[model samples]
Target: MSTPNPNPENRQINIIDPAFTLNPQPVYDEVLTRYRVAKTIGLNSPVISRYEDVIWALRHPEIFSSEMDMHVGLGTERPMIPQQLDPPLQTRYRKILDLQFSRARVMEIEPDVRRHANELIDQFVDAGECEFDRDFAIPLPCRAFLRMMGLPQEDLELFLELKNGIIRPPIANPYDIAAAKEYRAKTGKRIYAYFEALIDDREKSPRDDMMTYFTKVELDGKKLTRNEILDICFLFLLGGLDTVTATLGCSVFYLAENPEHRRRLAEDPSLVPAAVEELLRWQTPVTIVPRILKQDWELDGVQMKAGSMVSLLIGAANVDEQEFGAGEGKCVHFERERNRHIAFGAGPHRCLGSHLARMELRVGLEEWHRRIPSYSIKAGETPRVSPGIREVMYLPLVWEKGGAA
Candidate 1:
């Protein structure tokens, strides 16, 4: 194991650029090199980019707090439900929510997921060209999440708008913070109120869905409070909507660009699972996970005082030559055997809805391959969106109509 140099040479690290939006390679490379030499250092904020340092930080939760409110500063005060809570208590909340995302539960939702994907494709397949993000990527996961939570499908648009605000705030403009704050508060309240009523309804008349189970769950010999249940529900809504949306958009974009990779999967239909992992590694939708230092520690050579903020750059780590081998780091191969990537994060904080997300992606890819496998990016018309916390948005593609016929 190579240790980061304590008195390493200073190197210029580029944290941001005006031109780049989707592919943030320069920013990531700079951070990775700097973190390798210095262990932990301050950038836009402090970053802990090396794979080992990040894994250590995630494992040592006591020393690296997951209480994001403290780390996120005044930006967000609402507790992040189970994510913001630590052990024992955190485990309890996670257990209550885990059942909803369990493999069996996800299997139950597969038919609905396929139905939703086909329904969206049916609308746009005839158009021969459509903005995938708007037409398919956004609605598929949004509707799946709604169905899983037993929420009204009519509120999908509202849920998406609010969820995006929470995860990807407009950090470029300081003025946007106030608007984001207002949106957070308003959305948080509305979501809480909505879930609270749902909880009440479930308690009065329980059903087989998640809300009923949440209402009846007890932690440490006491029923979960209304606020806590609402917070958990909000987390589910935000986590499911944005992360899955970005991932699906990125995957579709990859297929459009790499027609060979798309062709292989389209022909062999069985390759969808491996292709999903490859897309996750190549795109890495959830780029960074921030942790607060609870106690003094030394990592990758740099000394750190307690109370410092550190971020794990999953995007950079996924591409590290030391981990993934030469040419393997590139997105060319979709069937790599050892395709373990931290796209869903790791450890206790690992994405709880991973199974459901995978199911959604598999269904989307399978259905898409059947209907619209041969698509290309529109000429002179590039699809793009923000690459901040979430890395993708709009993806436009053109296909020949009746190709599947």
Candidate 2:
């Protein structure tokens, strides 16, 4: 909202700094206040921090495209459907994905999601405390998503391991590119192999699930190939598995740290829905989305060359005063009248699993507060969040083992 620094100094932000990952708001505030666009010292990409610029780039994917040839590093053999593609082709795939993830269809999965939420709580509530991320945040979505896809729910642990292997490879050095790629490639193979068997099963007996839908759905009057379904499922493994978990982790952590906000939701259940949106805005789990420039583009006098990657700071934009607080930039309230935050992103590739995510978050929160209404971060233990998705991986929460518990 503040005028782009007319004579801005060279601002270099460490996009992946552990400290920044732990507490990124200060960095975001600094960027939003001083620079419309800055450069990431680690990734070396131009960081678009303003809400307007990020939204414009997202909407106009013709200029700022999502299609990139860097799948190997992302633990994928090929570009995943809809997500890694641009419009027209991307739009067609979305047509099919959108129907499968429509609100009505997501609503049908709600009862099971709610059941799983409460069931996860049942294990930890009696103990009066639990490591929230490891216990609840991860498994709930894993099982629910697997069930929704008609996959074997019993393989949730395997799926979690496989997903983590790709995202956060279990190695001593996080910065070892050779080790990281080797691990990701191995994990990618296993992921493909895992889905290949399931694809065969789904095809042998086409069922009433999303996996089957992918196998049968015709795009541009042609049925999707086996690889296409595998690609879609691969994207699902990344997007569906990680994003919702990140949202849940961040949402629960926020509630745990702020008692009044938690009390408001516990006392008045209706606020849970709005609270989900607010949390999504304030603590955008998927902090940065990568885009490649199809052609040269410039914003705020900073030139971005063609084919270079651009980092759209969704978290920074969501809290920008220009759009959020009428130029205040500190909008963290659940009762706000309007919140056009692109937390799920904007335009043709806006998250395909958003409906399911909202239902999961809303249900996850409703059932969580209903069971454990009074809780907080355990004393003397600092929670740790991840760099990319901003997931609070080690959130220890405690409460009295009675009343709602």
Predicted structure with the largest lDDT when compared to the true one: 2
Q: Model 2 — TM-score against the truth?
A: 0.97
Candidate 1: tens digits of C-alpha lDDT, residues 267-373: 98899988888888878878777777788877656676788766677777777656677656644576677876788887778889999999998898999998887
How much does each candidate deviate from the true structure in C-alpha RMSD? 3.0, 1.5
After the best TM-score superposition of candidate 2, give how far the Cα of residue 287 lies from its true spot, in angstroms.
0.8
lDDT (tens digit, per residue) of candidate 2 on 1-405? 356643333888886788988778998998998888888887788889888989999999999898998686877889999788998889988888888888998899899999999889988888899998889889988988987888887899899999999999999998999999999999999999999898888889998877788778898899999888889888899888778888999988888878889999999999998999999998898999999999997788777789999999988998998888764457568897888889999998898889889999999999999899999889999999888888888999989978665
In model 2, the runs with Cα more than 4 Å from the true position are 1-9
Clashing pairs in 1: none
Instruction: Count clashes in each candidate, considering only residues at least 3 apart in sequence or on different chains.
Output: 0, 0
Q: Which candidate has the top score in TM-score?
A: 2
Each prediction's whole-model lDDT (CA):
0.74, 0.87
